[model samples]
Every structure is written in structure tokens, then in C-alpha cells.
Target: MMMLRKFKIVLPLFFVASLFISSQTNANTDPNPKDKVLLTILKYVLTQGHYHPQTIDDTFSENVYNSFLERLDPSKRYFLQSDIDEFSNYKMQIDDQINNEDLSFFFLVYERLTQRIEESKPYYKQILENQFDFNNDDIFDVDYEKSSYAKNTSEITNIWHKQLKFTTLSRLNDKIIAEEDKKKEDETYQTKSFNELEKEAREAVIINMDESFERIEELTYSDWFSIFINSISEEFDPHTTYFDPVVKKRFDISMAGKLEGIGARLQKKNDYTKVSELISGGPAWKQGELEVGDYITKVAQGDGEPIDIVGMRLDDAIEYIKGKKGTEVRLTLKKMDGTTKVISIIRDVVELEETFVKSSVVKKDGRTFGVINLPKFYIDFDEKNFRSSSTDMAQEIERLKNENVEGLVIDLRNNGGGSLKTAIEISGLFIEKGPIVQVKYRDKNPDVKKDTDPKIQWDKPLVVLVNELSASASEIFAAAMQDYGRAVIIGGRQTYGKGTVQSVLDLNRYHNLKEDIGALKMTIQKFYRINGGSTQLEGVHSDIMLPDRYTYMNIGERDLENPLKFDKVPKATYKLWDNYENFNQAIDNSKKRIATNNYFKLIDQNAKWLKNSQDDTLIYLNYEAYKKDLEVHENESLKYKSLRDYTSNLTYTSPLYEQPLLEKDEDLAEKREAWHKNLKKDMYVEEALNVLSELKIKPQYHLVKN
Candidate 1:
């Protein structure tokens, strides 16, 4: 079966190459011959090469059908129930059509969607022209998943009317409040009447919708086809995706960790572009104004007038936000606290240094310990001599050893993983010689990846700090340490369950075609812990769990669609390290401390509040009611403000070796200073230090001094 699986994957490459060459020479005059070629190759690779390919049967077809519609019209504002009924005919036949390389279903949906989009332009324009009755008590359900498609034109029109009204009402309230605040500051200040403010709000909505529609009109057929292809590709797993040429370039830039932009990652949430993460040492991060969860509503270049981006596509919004180095980009954000703030940042090349491993020495209760923050398990595939996480980590640990640190805390929080080879090498640094992780390709025997070198770099007590975002390579290192009793894992419930390994296959490489066919990033293998457990949907459980804001939220691999199931392989033969005299005692001591801690109690409460906020999706259209709701939420949020302000008494400082480097680079010094300040405010780091203090090393296991 293993040989057959290998043969199946290899045979297609040769077959496709010959077929592609022949097809190109005698190419049909189809508008997008590349589309058919791409579709055929993508399907072949996924089905043959995927670690756990889904049977492309009726069930898979139905999944692709539903997923495509949702991706195209998540809010159900475009396609009506009648259109869905028409498209339902191919719901079960998609499998057969895909096998036949027929794009009839995609073409039908794409054409219908384009038509609906063009026709629906007048819905928002017409609705916004008239004044909204804010006095009437109307509610709009923001949870589109629970809502059904509109039955007819009137139903869809009503849906658009309520959505526009809800948006306009919020803006009107903000305008009115701003005017009142201005009058309060200066008694001579002229305040606009309620009617005039309302009109301005409606005009803003019209401009936003018009711009959004225009952007949508600009999308090529190829753009829609990418969405269609992805809907099918993602059915196998969330990580497996088909990247078009444009998307592939962006992916490569992200991997390189060098780009000219605001250095903030944005994701499209409904009609808004939300700030997902602010890259450390980037312009936005240095500015200290933008934050995760804030919705960007408008963007302006330098001193130019702010252009509304409320309804713009994610890509389009990103283009407006990113610019050449030394340019200023201004963003108006709708803050999480129901307030708006405009922040300006001078864009610069996002420094990649922050993403690499950095260590800080801190003294707590007269004991010195080292804290190493590894953002990701990075490696440069093209340049083998380039710096990697494993090499950098070993060097950092050696530097800490020179400082005579008693214990170490490896911070893997928010690390979304990178090179698999680096993860094994890093794990090998702590252990003498043993299997670090077990990897299994489809239908093949588990391959035990071991540390052939018998040298133990750090024999001292080690504690790994992780969160829900720590994934893939992060999980591998943490899991290996946990299995071997080499380190105490601390932080969230578990790491992100991303055990699958993916390899990006350049589709254009299969044939000598000039056309850009793009690439496919597909899963090829799964990694397992040495103890036999697979970190597919159930990640490595931390020895000491910490209360975080994402505790009650639905996150991690299980929350994703079509995730691989958890399974176990035969445990690798290895001896556990018995170096610690009080490993269990340290965990118990930490747990007891956390139970009595007020900060943790407040964090738990805040997590519940956040989950409740996520679940409550209804929006009041009436101005007074909406204002009251916002005020209530704002007041409630005040109780948890101390969680942000809570700081530990411990002081963090740069190692003696880094002082000279810091003196030479002002930006580096500033970044390190900021990081140290943040460490002082980190309760988790304080707890890790406390645990490290309790972790007494056995006398026999102590390392001899040079």
C-alpha cells in the first residue's frame, strides 16, 4: 500500500507533464485554458499526494458546493434562494464534473454572482438616499450563519435596507457625540443639527458602498475562479490551499519576513478589514496605537483625505494600507471599546530581527533565570548558510550559560511554526540522544527522528511557555520535552494542534509552459509525539495551564473545518529524564498560586465576557438603544482593565554581551527596552520564574563548571 501510494503520487507528475505539453500545442481557444489545466492538476495532486485525502464522493461534492457559496456570499446578501435552488442541481454532480475537468458549476455560480452584484448596486444606494427612522425599535441580526437566504427581490431589498440602516445609525451617533464634545470644549463651537448629521452619515454609507461595488466589479474572472478552486481544495483540510500567482507572491514575502508596508496583518471580517496581528518592530507596532481586533474603517496616504474602506475587499484594503518605505499611512480604527481613533504611522521596512530568538535575563527573589522568546521556527531554504532557529537558539542558550543562569524559560507564545527540521534540532539541544518525534507519511511506517549527537547543551531545569497560538514545530518541541520529562510546559490549555506537514508544489514546474499555473500547498505527512499521541486535533496538554483571554473562545485545530482526527502510533523506546527532585511539586505549587491570584480570576471573567460578546450578535438600529448598549459594555469592560495594568515586581535586563550591540543600534535598543518593559508587566513570566525556582535539580545531574 505504501509503495502504491508513492507510485500513485509520482505517476501523475509524468502523466500531467506530457498531457499539459500536448494540450498546450493543440490548445482549445477557451478564454482561460489555464483554468482547466490548473483545476485538473490541483485535483490530481490533492487526491494523490494529500496525507489524508477525502474520498471525492457525493459528500465531498456537497461540502465543496456549500463552502463555495459561503465564501462568495458569507452574508447571504448576493445570491437569493431562487438562485441557490437553481445551483442545487449540481450539488451531487460536482464530483463527477470535477473528475471530467468540467467547470460548468463554477461558471454558472460565477456568472450568476456577477449579475446579482451588478443588479444589487442600487439596493444600498436607494436605501441610503432616504432618512432612517432611528426612533423605531428595529434589530439587525449580525450573525449571518443563522440567517437564511432571501426568498425574493423584496426580501433581499429589506435585508440590504436593515444592514445599511444599522451601519448609518452607528455613524450618526458618533457624529452627534463628536459635535456635542466639541461644543463642550469650546462654547462658541457650532454643533450640527441631528438631521444634518444623519444626512452626512447616509452619504458616508453611499460612498462606502459605491466604492465597494466598484472594487468588486474590478475583480477578474480568474479571481472568482481562485475562490472556487480553494473551496474544493479546503474540503480536504484547512491548511491545504491553492495559491494563485498573486497570492503565491504574498505568501513568499510573508515567509521572507521582509516587506514594505504598515507591518500589520489584516483579515476580512464581513465588510470590515480587521487587524489580526501587529508585527513586532514594524511601524504599527512601534507607533503603539493599533491593536488586534480593531476594525480599520478608513485609510489615508500622508496628508490626503481619508478614504472609506469599510466595505472594501481584504486585498484592496491591504494595497491602500501598504506603501513604499518612508511614506505615512493614516488609519481610522473602530476600537474594541466602541470608540474610534485615527492613528498615523510612517511606514518602514519591517525589521526581521524581532522574529528571531532573543533572550533576556531577569532576577526574581535573588535567583537569576534566562527567558528566551522564539517567535517562530524559521529557516531559509534557499540559503542553507543563513541563520536558523535551531542554531540561533543554541547560541542564545550558550550565552545564557555564560551568565550562570540557574534555570531557563523558553517562550513559544504566538509562534505559528516554520521549519520541521529546525524543531527537531532545537529539541535535540536539551536531550542527550533519543527519538524526538515520529513522522508518518501516508500508509508508511512511522519514521523516528532521533538526535544522533549525544551532547546535552542545557541540563538545567527548563520551562517552556506556550499559548493557543503555539503550533506545528512549536508543538513538536514542547511535546518531545514533555514526553522525555525534559521541560515543564506552561501556558494555555494546549498548543495549536497542527501536526500535518505541507509541501508547496509549483504547478508550472510540471510542464514547460509560459503561462503561470500557480502552486498547491498540500499536506503530505503527520508528526507524532514520541509517546505515540498524534497532535492532530488534540495538541500537547500543558503541565501547568494558565488562564488567558482565549480560554473560553473556540480556537485551535478542532474549531477549523474538516480537521484530521486524533490517533496514536506505537510509542518509541526512550528513557525519561529523572533529573528534577520536585517536578510534580512545582506544578502543584504553581496551580495553588494561580488559584489564589486575583489577576488570573479577573482573566477568567474577561474570557467569559469575550465569549459572551462573540455570541451576542444582535445590533439595535435605534440610536438611543445602541448608545445605551455601548455604554453598558464599556462600563462592564472597566472591571477587567486591571488585567492589562497588572505588572510583576521582577526586572528584566539585556545580557552583558548584548550591551555593546544595543549601544550601536538605536532602534535595536529601543525595541529591547520595550520588550523588557512588557516582560515586567507579564504575570505568566513571573509564574514561570516561580516554578523554575521550585524546580530543584538532583545533585547527581548537576553540570560541572569549566
Candidate 2:
């Protein structure tokens, strides 16, 4: 959401694991026979364990070949037509090779890719070494998703030329703005000519590309092998992926939501490791010194000399920063304005409570409501007494019940979901022992996961808030709640649409192999709502739809490359929640309020303009036209700025018990206060309360169960 203007690189740096492998490969450059072993085990899983097993045939082989190439070079800027032609011979033969447990195709492609990368290094360097003619009347189409591979070296050279020029222009634009700002700040400030700025931009590009090539050299053969293996596994489904041991470890740590290190998401952006997001209540966020978009230039251990990480691989940089709890890691960061600072943070176990279930009490219109924000349906698998979202949510509900809340609102915005078992348990809190969801596996009839518990937690007026980012378990909870007429689903047009469930299988356990080949996360089941509708491509629809920034964006499972299709099963026999009889009237009242709401109108316009900008792929090479377009966009974007400041005249406060806890912890109190302030500004929450008010009205008709 925070867009850093000229610092943005159009290309995705590298696939997470691929770049990590590329960074750490220099020390141990040994041949890994595990590739064949991994391939064998992966194929077995796809064929035997996958929900939708793909056949290993000519068709599958050709897809594997193309998909691998696409993964290797998504921008179509690396390999050429000749490379594709040379690799065409193995297209159909890939099926035979995989069938025979061979690695010929993978080996051929990986070797050739390595060779092309080495050969193309100088091409970008030579291009960036010279000054770019920004005055030239040319436009670069940035959408390479539909573009074809280059025909020859000449064509590839042209593509590289355009790429470098585009990058240079972007950097130059940033410099010009900075110089102008400086001139305004100082009366006697001198600004450099366009040519001088152009040279600086080119030099910057050259330095970055050189660092990129050097880092590429660190890529081990095993890393590329993982990429290829993942390409094959992903062909089955987008959710299916092969994680090598290192990546698997990182994946596990991330899923656990607690790690003994600095709690900031670090990403490799052109030779610099940028702090992407800070985990709230984590070390970085708690320190309040490290910030999103801050470039980590150097890292050091406790009292140790700082080592420069400017051109270091992100994985290596992370290694220097990540330490055991109670240890210290120092970071040298570069700010956006080109200022530098040193910050030392004592590493601790950052438990990501923000991603867990949390509750707040809102008092509006002389009535009280409890809002529960469940970012993810997290579950700790290792510990027998591990905390789960279901238990946490139930506790929060009980806490809210003690406050005597008149209505309840569950906010699942941006929750990508977690344990399916947790989802069922969470849903059970609202209903009196019934089927939560129907899951279907390969060739198996739908199995109804029932919550046999007959006790209802808070079967009163309820509302759920979701957005396009809400997915999987979130969708399951929302859909089940919607089907039972237990709650009014609000926000986004639809959820993230991820209906399928993935189970991680350790490859070592598959064949009882003694080696740590890695793990495979494969989609093994698809879930359906209690009303029989699949939440696959079509996620759960909101009972009261609200427009947000992502309303017009292609960001759901349906927008993914190879997502599972939506279908239906027989509806389960279940009783609906008889709590709200005037649900339809309440929805109508909310829609009427939304129709005349100025905040929503502005949001709709912002969404439309944002989508238009996203669709605009062409970039002007001429600086004048480029600046003009950018200024137009900047001016247009200003109108939406007021939306962030828009706050409703509503009050949100913590429960009495929570207030004492907040009082004890100043940091927690501050966070909750900020959260309350944000909630006041949230138009969707305001409307949800209105829905709650309407739901509190007596029903004209009796509620019935299906």
C-alpha cells in the first residue's frame, strides 16, 4: 500500500527460494544427486496424492517445458527464440524422461539458462555504460506477460537496451525531483543539467547490474534444480510447490508466526535489502526505529564490526541479522532521502499476535459492539498444547460476552487462512453442533466436517467483515456463517477464492529416504460451503458488498494461472441460526445507506482510477511526456488522499478487562489506541454497525432451518 516512487523495480527480483539459493551457492558447489530423488518422489506425490493428479504424457511434458521457461524468464527478456528452438527437441521427450526417472530435460534447460545469463551480463553493462537518449520518441511496453521470446541476439540486445533505458529514465526522474526539492529548500542551491543527471542514472544502473551478475554467479546448481522441480509441481496446481530443506525451514518459521530474529520482512530489491513490512509487536516494530522501505545496507552481530550487505544476497544478509533470542543485531539503513542511520535491536522471539485473534469493543449510537480481528486461522502444530485460532477466538468471544456486547463483528480482512480444523472449530462457536464444511478429495465423496459441540458462544446479532484478501479458512468461516444466516457478511465484492486445501508432505518420509531432499506442499482437497457452493474460483459473496482499492484488481484465486474450478455438492442438512429474522431488511438498509455515502463514492472512484493506472502498461521514453503523465496521475491521486483522513463520528474502546492490561503495557495501550483511531476512520466498520443496529430490530417473520 505504501508506494515508494522511483525506488520501485518493475521486475520481481527473483523467486524467493531461487534468489536465496543463488546467494548461498558459492561456498558449497557440489553436485546434488538429490534432484533425481526429488523428481521421483514429487512425481509419485502428484500421481498418487494430489487432489487432481496430472498425467505424465506428451501434453504434460510440453506444459512442463513451457512453464519452466516462463518461470525462468517471465519477462521474456532472458532467453531467445534460438534457445527455445534448441530446447524444443526435449519438449515431448520430457514425458518419457520423467516416466523413466530421468533428469535430461531439466539438466539441459538449467545449463543453457546459466550459459545465457553469463553471456547476457555484458549486454546490459555495455548498454548502461553509455548515456541514454531520453529525447528519443519511443515507448516501451512493459507488459511482457504476452510478449514472445526474442528471435536472435540482436533482438535480445534491443530488449535489454529498452529495459536499461527505462530503468535509467526512472532513476533520472527521481533525481530531477530531488534536485528541484533541494533548490526550493536552499536559495543558492545549484541543480545539475539533464545530461549530468542522466550520467549518474546510467552509472547507478551499471553498478546494480554488475552486482546482479555477481550474485547470479553464486547460484548453485541445486538452487536451479529446486526452481525446475517447483515448476513441475506447480503445474499440478498453483498451491502445489516443492520446497528444498532451507526454504522448507523458512516456510515453517513463517507459518509458526514466531521467530527468534528481527521481525521485519526483508526483500532483495536490485542489490539492496529493503524492509518490506514490520511484524507488529515484533522487535523491529517495537523498536520503532526500523521502518518499511528502509534499505538495509549493512548488518552486524553484537558488538561486532558491521559487514556491508549492499550487494550481498538477501539470504546471506538475513543470516547475519537473524540470531537467537537475547542476542543483538545491528543494521545500517539508508533512508529514502539518502540519509543513513545505525540501529541495534536485541533479537527476541517475535510472536505475531497481530496475525492472531484480537478483540475490541465499540460504543456507537448508545450501544456496544465487539469487533474481533482474525488475521489468520493460525495453529501451532509442534506443541501439543499449541495455541490455535479457534481456542483464541472462543476466548475472545467469551471476553466480549463479559462486556455485554449487543452485537458482534468478526473482521477477517486480509486473512489468507490456516488450519482447516481451526476453521471448523471457529465456525462451531456460532452454531449448535452441525456440519461446518464439506471437503472432497480425489475420487472420494465429500466428507462433512462436523462440530459435534452443541454449545453456542455468542448466537446474537453478528456481522463479518471480509475483503478480497480474506481466503481459505476465512472464506470457510464466512460462508458457513452466511449459509446459517448467523451473520451478515460485509466488505469486498468477494473473498480471495482459495477453496482448495494443501497438506505439506516431507519427501524424506515418502519413501523412508534417509536424505533431507525437501518437502512438498500439495493441494489434496477442495472445500464447499454448507449450502453446497464451492469457494474455489468464486469466493464467498458478501451479504453487503463494499468497494475498496482492490475491488477492480485481479487478485483472487480466479486471477491465478491454474486455479481449481468451482463446483457444488449436495447441501448438508443443518439448522440455520434463528437469531436474526430481519436479515434481508438489515441488508437492504445497509445498501441504502451505502448508496448515499460520500465515503463509498470516493472509494469507488479511487478503485476505478487505480485499475486504469494498473492497466496502463506503456511508458514514454521522452521525459516530457513521462513527467506529464506522472504529474497527471499525481494530481488525480490527490483527490483520494482525503479518504484516509475521513473519520466517522463513532467511538471504539477496549473492554474493561482489556483496559487494565493495556494500562500495564504502554506499548499495547498505544497500539490499541491507534487501532481504535483507524477503526473510527473505517467507513466499512461504520456501515457494519448500522447493519448491527438494523439487525437488532424485531423480526416480522419466523426464522427457519434448511
Candidate 3:
């Protein structure tokens, strides 16, 4: 799967909708009365306040119809062709239903899906009762998007058999290989027969399926209703989403950057919850067991019996993993290499320190350069005095200047944006003062967000590092730097083109009802660079482009459905930085170096190989053929193994002020050590420093270290 770790909490600005509901409530009793009110408010706000509201017509209806069904049964396994045929009747009529606040289509599909899910349980149980023939030459195409739904119950049963057999065969192969390896390790080791191993794999699949169904059975009506609502909301834009009360609470916690848990983000993949990211300095990271891609199979509290979580809902699985601070939560993980490990962690308040700005000083040749890695433009919306990225960045710059670092590299790679105000503030620190970005609401003239502060904090040579994952506020900062000729933008062909600004509107505020109607995160404004170009579809083009893993992949805002189109506005008045005499020369020199660099060449080749591998999703169900395919890919992957071992000739160290803090806190020390080590291996940072070194400062602007 293509893992795009997108941080979608962009610019948390709130705008109260000016909606007024009449005192006349619905006299007719309905189970979900709030649904109608929510839908009515949602339509009004989206059409009136959205930056580019989509037309809700027959086309919109068809899109939602297709999207909702696909989401309900993505594998094309649950619902049959008959079910699809029935659902298609209201495909075009959905627009009218939505306009009238009618829930007939939603109710029909929801009820049918619930019925189909219950019916499909026996199919898997019956299929797994017998051994799968691994010797047969069968191929399972994993491209479910292209696969057709089964015509009848018999056809669906056959499809289930193939899918279960594919799942079992893979496990059987793993068991066979493990037995052989054990036999080789000890000459007198006993090995089980193929039939015996096949039975064990089948049993394992049964357990997993049962747990999956159990989790599905636990889904409440609210869960399904949220999905139906989102299916409509997402058709407007990818980022715009409806957050039910439960999900909205989670979003708030995530934005606050403090949670009482083990500090690992989990995503449901197939029947397992995979570890997406581990918060640095969190309990799990401190314990040093959980890793990204590891499947969390079971979770236990304190010394209790482990509860299998392989098929559990992500929200439920998290409940088992998270606990009050000082409580123990043990997790059973199925590692990527097929080994199982039980890890215990004492839950704590995991303050996401890594989400803030962190800086490191590195020495190249004889001069020092500073690298500031800003994960996001974070700001506490609730507290005015709370730490903000802009203030932290300003302080870090002053500290770097105190250390007499000659150049600065602001690393915004993988920073999927946060606060817009902070981005503009941070941009002002580099330049004297000018309009940073233009924000345009629907049918309104562009409002210029400027940095009125004329004091330039860092007049020295500056380089900004961005990649395909740098989005929203990150784009705003990078664009401002590029437009004003302030910083030399490097890495990736373009940044993530997410120019739209979103504002969370509390839906309950529009009504006098005591019930919580949750909030709507809708796109309210589209931002543009000072040079008039919108970074909506085409992100900021890097001045010094470099090849990365996602070089050939279809990523960013344009890849998303119904993204706003790129357009231009009147350019804001801003003066270009004329202090750097060899700006063009620095870029040209880096391009020449990157052209012949073996490491970059290997990276480009690896990216192409990865793209091809991702495209070839077909799996050989026969054991021998499956093993052979894996072996071929494994050998091919060995060619790019050296990429991990490549390192640069640079020494990175923590800043002087942070040195004392690191010595006191071992976790902080360890985090910085790991960061410095990665910096040493980073070729991009090395190249960025090279460009910074080549940038010749104007004679009058040059300063001597005190």
C-alpha cells in the first residue's frame, strides 16, 4: 500500500455559522431526528461558506452512491451484485432525497449492509472447515477495485473460498519455511507433515475471522450513520469531513498534542491494527519495542489475559491499549518478519514534543550550519500564551545566531501543516517584511496576510527543505520564501498542493437544541502565493529539485478527488532579497552534483522499482509459485539495501542550551542522538548545507562573530 502519512489538522480556525433554525420542531417521531437538522445545516454551510462548493445534482448523487457502497464493502466481498443492483435504483434520486432531508436511501443501504454482513459470517466458517489445496495453480487478483461482485450466493461462496485459500496458503508457506529453518538449526529437530501444518493455518484463519466478525457486530447505528454522512461530505472535497461527537473528541485530543496513552497511532489494515507512527519520547518509544508496520494482535491491561485485537475496530483497539497514566498496557505484536512479541508499557501523558520545532547544529568543513526541522506550524488555539511554532522558531534562530552558525536550513519535509498564523509569522523572521500569502473566500477579494515586522531575524543565506508531503501552511511558508527570493527551496519536484484553509464550525451553535450535533471541518478559503499563483493543484516548484522515493508516485492534492482548481489573483507587493549574489550559481552547482551522484541515481532507480512493485498486486495462490515470486522480489530489493547505509561526512550536535536539558532527561538525550544520527545519514541535508555554503553574502551584509 502507498503510505502517505498526511497530517490533515491544517489551520484550526473556527467560524460560527450564521444559521437560525425555527422553533418549530418535527412533531413526527423519528429515531435519528438530529440527522435531518445536521443535513440541512451541512448543506447550507457548505454551499454558502465553502471556498468552492460543488453542485449537488444528479452527478453528485451518483458519486456519493458509488463512494458509499465502495466504502461499505471495499473488498467486493460482503455485498452481492443483487445488492448493488437494488442500491443503483436510487443512485440519481439521492440528490433529491438529500435536498428534502429524506433518509430512505441511507436507511435501505444501511439495513441491507447489516443483513449481508450477518449472512456472510457462515460463508467464511464453512469455507475454512476444510484444507486448502496449495498444490493447485490458482491466482488471486488483489485489485478488488476492478473485480466484479458475485452474481449469486453460489458465486459469492466460490469467491470467499478463493480468498480464504489465498490467506491460508500464505500462512502455510510461512509455517513450512519456519519448520525447515528449525530443522536446519538442529539436526535432531522434529518437523510436522504438510497436512498437519495446513490444519493449523486453517484454524488460525478461523480465529481471525471470528474476531473480525465480533468487532463488526459491535458497530452501533451511529458508526454506520457517520460513514453515510461522510460519504456525502467527502464528495465536496477530500479534506472536508464530518466528525461525529466521538471522532470530533479524538480530533481535539490529537490537535492538543497531549494524550494519556502508549503514544502510538494505529490504523486498521485487513484484520490487524498496524502501528502507523510512534510518538517520540512517548511510553512506547521509550520502551523500544513497537515499530511502524508491526501488527498489534492482542492487548492486555496490567497482568490480565491478552484479548485478541487482530480483528478489532481501531477505536476499540485503542481503548484497550490506552489507559490512565502509570497503568500498564501490554501489547502482543506480530512483527513484519512473522515473529510475535509481547511488550509491556506504562501509559503516561504523551506530550508530542516532536511535533514542535527542533534544531541541531552541524559542522561541515570548518564552518557551522543550523538545521531546524519543523514538523508542523503548531499553535494552541485555546491558550494565547502557549508555545507556538513561530515563537519557538524565532528563539531557535537567535540561539543558532549565538552559536555563530553561518547558514540555516529550515526542514519542512513531511510537515502536513497546522496553523496559518504561525506560518506567516515564521516567514517574517527570514524576510524584512512583506505580504506572505493571499487568502480568498468565496466571491471575495483576496485578503493579504502580511508580516508587518520589519526586523529581519535571519538575513544570512537560508535554504528550505520540502517534499511531496509538505502541505497547507508548509506550502505557504515555502512559497513566500521562494517568491521573495529569500530561501533556496530544495528537495522534491513540488510540495504538497494543499492551498485551501479549513475552519471548524460547531453545528450545535446554529440551533437551540441541547443535543450535540458535532462540528464540520469545511474548506473556507484558498490561499495563494505573493506572486499570484495558487498552490491548490500545482505546489511550489523547488528551486533545487532532488529525487526522492515519491518522485514518480501520484501524490498531493491533485491526486485527491474534487480538489480545487489552480487559479491566479493579483500579485501582492513584495521586494526580493538581493543580498545573495550567487543564488542562481548555488542552484546550478547543486544540480550538476546531483546529476552524477550515485546515491541519488540509486534512489531514482529504487523509486521506479517500488512503483512497479506496488502496481503488480496479483498474488500466486499456489505455494511454490508464491514462494518463488517472493524470492524474486526479495533479491531485487537487495539491490537498494545500500541506500540505508549511505552517510554524509558531517558532525551534528545539539545546541548549547539544549545540551543541559538533554543531560538531565535521558529520553530527550536519546531522541536528539537518534535525530543527529539520522542527520548524519541525510544526503539532502548535506546537499542543502553545500548550497548554503556556496551562497555568497554581499560584502556590506556580512557579519563577524562576536
Candidate 2: tens digits of C-alpha lDDT, residues 118-224 = 88877987887788877888898867766779998899999888877877786687679879999999979989999999998888777766655766787787677
Residue-wise C-alpha lDDT for candidate 1, range 564-681, written one tens digit per residue: 8899999999999878899999999999999999899988888788778756768898888998998888788888889878888899999989999999999889989999999999
lDDT (0 to 1) per candidate: 0.85, 0.78, 0.81
Rank candidates by TM-score, best first.
1, 3, 2
Q: Choose the strongest candidate by TM-score.
A: 1
Instruction: Give all candidate RMSDs, comma-separated.
Output: 3.4, 8.9, 5.5
* Greater-TM-score candidate between 1 and 2: 1
Per-candidate TM equals 0.92, 0.83, 0.87
On lDDT, the candidate that comes out on top is: 1
Show pairs that collide, candidate 3: none
- Give the least accurate 10-residue stretch of model 3, judged by summed lDDT: 1-10
Give Cα distance to truth, residue 224, candidate 3, Å: 1.6
Over 4 Å off in model 1, which ranges?
1-14, 17-30, 268-281, 284-312, 330-346, 381-385, 511-514, 703-706
Stretches off by above 4 angstroms in model 3 are 1-29, 177-187, 260-349, 381-385, 512-514, 700-706
Q: Is candidate 2 or candidate 3 better by lDDT?
A: 3
Worst 10 residues of 1 by lDDT: 1-10
TM-score of 2: 0.83
TM-score for candidate 3: 0.87
Q: Which residues of candidate 2, in runs, are more than 4 Å off? A: 1-34, 258-350, 380-387, 510-515, 697-706
